[model samples]
Target: MTGKSLSERIGDLGRRLAVEAHTAWLAARDPRVAWFARLLAVAVAAYALSPIDLIPDFIPVLGWIDDLVILPLGLLAVRRLIAAPLWSELHALAETASERPSSRAGMILILLIWAALLAIVYWAVRTSPLH
Candidate 1:
């Protein structure tokens, strides 16, 4: 292994992930990317930025697994779908961009989704025979 400490490596990985997510965000907005790839890119970027997860972080092992595995895999798939030259261009742009973008719209969408799910659960419980 390299001489760098574990914390240094972790820091580097975090930075790389940040750049990759930013690149995916850029690809999502670019018309040059295929429709399917753009859709996937948007999903990956939203999930990366959103506070909610498919699995709650309180769950043992599995919750952290999604963050560690699913995200990087999704980013990798987006990278593969994009042409090499285009991907490189986007990566460079992402690294150089002054401001890392935040998605208020994505946050709102996530909140709406959670609200709907909560409402459904409440309705179900209220209507249940055991209630």
Candidate 2:
């Protein structure tokens, strides 16, 4: 059999990578994906922050290899599980998440809700007490 040209091989690789990325993006939307995602996210975080490296950053051209390669590869692996159609749905979910509240405002709203709930509980407890 004849060998494939470089361009054809590259195209095939690109298609495979794209499919993997889309699959990963789809998987990210499912609650079932949480366990594996969390584990991968944790590992990625550790790799980013860890002192160890395949090519230490002090070595100039080689130093950033981990940053350029490992992180992207890990992310791609995660993306491979994501489904393509769910991407739009996830975008909508992301927009809703962002529009709801900034973190500070969300925290304040949660505190206020908890205070109101506590007040109701207190009233119920006091009003119903035989003591």
Candidate 3:
């Protein structure tokens, strides 16, 4: 282990961590993985919003180590709770999101509806000074 190649090791770790987090997120988005995904999302949010850190942020080189290490570990742990069918559905959803839509009309309809809701919300908020 001469020279110790710190950069290479860190890069590899980063890649793995990203894949794990993404896989968990995708799995959670699927209806089959809904329950587990919601739970995982909650836990991740809690950890992110909590002021406390597993590894305190005072250390120089490893201040945010918990963010890197703990998140990936939690993602992997959530991944274990996912089922095969849900994973398959999630992969299908990913593929669908990448493909161009077949119906421009449908997309336009959805956009119009969203825009209308946004307009209504904007009007309501603007009229209400408390908001």
Best by TM-score: 1
lDDT of 3 by residue, 1-131 (tens): 57648898888776555444445556655565558566885576466556788777898758787877788677667756777666556556545554545898998999999999999999999999897
Higher-ranked by TM-score: 1 or 3 = 1
Q: Count the backbone clashes (under 3 Å) in each candidate.
A: 0, 12, 0
Better of 1 and 2 by lDDT: 1
| TM-scores for the candidates | 0.69, 0.37, 0.47
Per-residue alpha-carbon lDDT of candidate 1 for residues 7-125, written as tens digits (9 for 90 to 100): 99888888899899999999999999999999999999999988999998999999989989999999999999999999999999999883668799999999999999999999999
Encode model 2's per-residue lDDT on 35-121: one tens digit a residue. 777466456545645688888889997897666788668865554544545544654554454356468888999999999999999
Assess candidate 1 and give its TM-score to the true structure: 0.69
Q: Give candidate 1 regions above 4 Å deviation.
A: 98-131
- Candidate with top lDDT is 1
lDDT of candidate 3 at residue 24, scale 0 to 100: 57
lDDT (C-alpha) at residue 78 in model 1 = 96
Model 1: lDDT of residue 35: 99
Which residue pairs collide in model 1, if any?
none
Worst 10 residues of 3 by lDDT: 16-25
